[model samples]
Structures are given as C-alpha cells and as structure tokens.
Target: MSTFPDYYALLGVSKTATTDEIRQAYKKESLRTHPDRLTKATVEERKVATEKFQAVADAYYVLSDPSRRSEYDILYRTKAGNKSSDPGSSQNFFSQFANMFAGASTGAGTGAGPHGAMPGHQPDANGVFADVFEELLRPEVERVVPWWSYLGAACGAGLGFIIANIPGVMVGAYAGNRLGAIRDAKGKSVAVVFLSLGGSQKAAILRALALKVLGSAGM
Candidate 1:
C-alpha cells in the first residue's frame, strides 16, 4: 500500500475546518511554496518546495470535495488509531489518486502549463513558466476585477519568474558584488547577464517585478 500523506497536515488545516478556511490555507501555502517563487534557492530547497507545493494542492483538491474529503477522513482516522502498532500502515490513498496528484505536481491539473502533454514532458521552460504565472495570479486578479487584459500581465510575470530563477544566474548581494549591473526604468539594478534581452523583454521583466511586489504586499 502507498503512504497516504496527511492531507490536513499538509494544508495546515483541521478535520473540523470549514471549506473557506481550507481554501484560504491552500492559497496562502501555494503562494509561499510555489517552485517559481524559490528561483534563487538551492536545488535541494527547490525540490522541497516543489514537493510541498504539490502536497498543498493535493490536500486542497481532496478536501474541497465533500465525498473525497469523507473518504480521506476515514483513512486519516484509521491511520491515527493504528499508528503505534503498525507504524508502516497507511491507506492506499496515494495509489488511488496517483494520476490526479501527479498532474497537479507537473503544473497541468491547474491548467497553469500545457495540457494533454505527457508527464515530465516540458518542451519549453519559458512557456511553462509563463503559464504557471498566469494561473497563480488569475484567482487574485479575477477576484477584484476579472479582465482578459490581465493576460498581458500574466505573460510578463511568467517571464520574470523564469529569468529571475534561471540556473547560474545569481543576483542580490552575491551578484551585486561580482556581476555589477545596469539600471532598468524602475531604477532597480538588473544583473549584466540579462543585458541580452531586447527592449520589449526588458519591459516585461520590469512589469512582472512590479506586479510581484504589489501582489506580495497584498495590494
């Protein structure tokens, strides 16, 4: 039997928590644990974030549905009761929903990235990042003022996430001391490595940075 992750624990929620509470937890955790948000982190850190983000999504998906949540609650209770004697026992919950959670892990179930693509098949990192950004920000934007025009902002955010996290592209203090830099329109000093971008790409990066900053500030 597969090890069933503690869905409530993963979401930082309780069995008695309300739907809205679970959702709020999911959104907050998703923002924090999203792999793109950890671009500057080490590979090990990124891996942990990826797994955590996936688990958060999984927890939300199961608990949001009444029937699924009921099934999970039973298993969770069983595991808790049998924890001491059979420390290795866990429901086959993972196997039953492997495909569903797997899709979420790959950025597919959320429709943030390409759909209908096989698992582990990421043909274009740029497109993947772009889609992920759009999906991440869509819920918040729609909540205030739903508009298609926001797609432009999402595209820019996606590109920014990718460039900011690109492997070997260090920034902040480390890069500040070594790479030096050029200032963009926003007056933020961009690393020299990104000087290759054209005017349009540069603008997109800046726009993304601005949106990210505002979003984080709860604007």
Candidate 2:
C-alpha cells in the first residue's frame, strides 16, 4: 500500500470542508507557520516552521485541485480506518515531500559555487531552472492529450496542404501524430512521478515560479 499525507489534517480542515474553508485554513496555517514569521527563532525552530509551511502548502495544493482532490479522497477513504501504530508514520510521509523541497532550497541558497560558498546569496541557475521547468510542465504532464493530439494532426495536415500538396499533408499528419504521442508519453511518465510523490509537493514550486512568470509578463 502506498503511503499518503492526511491533507485535511495538515490544513486543519475536516474532510467535509468546502473549498473556501480549505483555502481559509491554508491561509491561516501558512501565515502562522511561515518562516519569515520566526525571525527571532533559533535555526532549528525556523527549520521546523519551514517544514510545517511546506506541508501546509502541499496540503492546499492537493485539496484545491478538484481532480487531484478526488483521487486523494478515494485513497483517504481507503486508508481511513487503518491507522498505523508507528509514531513516525506522518513524519515519514512529510519528510518524503520535504526532502525534495529541502534539496531545492539548499541548492538555491548555496548558489553555483564549487565549494557551496558564494559571496552573495546568488540563485543556483540549474536548480532554479529545474524547479521552474518541473512546475511549468506539471499541468501539461497531468493533461489528457489524445484529443489534442488529433487536433495537432489535423492542423498540421491543413498547414501542409497549403504549403505543399497531398504528400506534405501526409507527412505533416504523421509528424504531428508522433509529436503528440511523444508528449502523451512524457505526461504519463510525469504522472507516475506524481503518484509516487504520494500526491503532494508542486504547490510551493508553483508559487515561486508564478512570481517569475507573472513578473516577466507584467514587464
């Protein structure tokens, strides 16, 4: 059996909570646990807060997405009464997601220095690029691509017919179909990773990337 987070508990919401309620709970929890709110705290305290914030963000991300939430609900129901006796079960689950974020954070903080020491806190280009790519492609990776694939083939054929003739149209359709199938397969692979994640971790990355994407668009 795959392990999963109790997102509802993480967000301090009941299973029956409405979307708005969940959003409210997330906002409250996020603010309360945000690392910035612990400026005076010791390093360990701040670390704990950061982890809590990530978990809250992860919970919100899953619970807010209707389809993902539905999948989670099914799994949650299946595991509902089967409480583990191990005290570390929840911590283990959170750590799986946290480790991903922690690595990203560490890389970003340390920057691209060979010794993990940079003069200023420069952004790690590779780490940032990887996170951005993962977050941006996540939705596409979750999308159903069959209809889009057919559409791509049709569009390709039409364009080819205009440019060349029947031969071009046939070539274009084949190329487009292959491209679509490639994308579909890529999405399936990413979807498998999503399931392996136990249904969390993209939201914090999305939030970070959204600022960059939206900032560029505005400028």
User: Best candidate per lDDT, number?
Assistant: 2
Candidate 1 ranges beyond 4 A from true positions: 1-3, 81-92, 96-136, 139-219
For model 1, state the Cα shift of residue 194 in Å.
20
| Tens digit per residue, CA lDDT, model 1, 1-219 | 345577677667777998778766666565565555543579989777666655555566566656556766766777653322111121234445433433333333332234222332312322322333444433333333222234434444455456776432333334432222221222321222123444444334434544563364221
Candidate RMSDs in Å, in order, are: 15.2, 16.2
Error of 2 at 50 (Å): 0.8
Model 1 scores worst on lDDT over the 10 consecutive residues at 82-91
What lDDT does candidate 1 reach at residue 39?
39
Supply the TM-score for candidate 1.
0.45
lDDT of 2 by residue, 13-76 (tens): 8889987787666655655555543436899897877667656655655565464467557666
TM-score of 2: 0.39
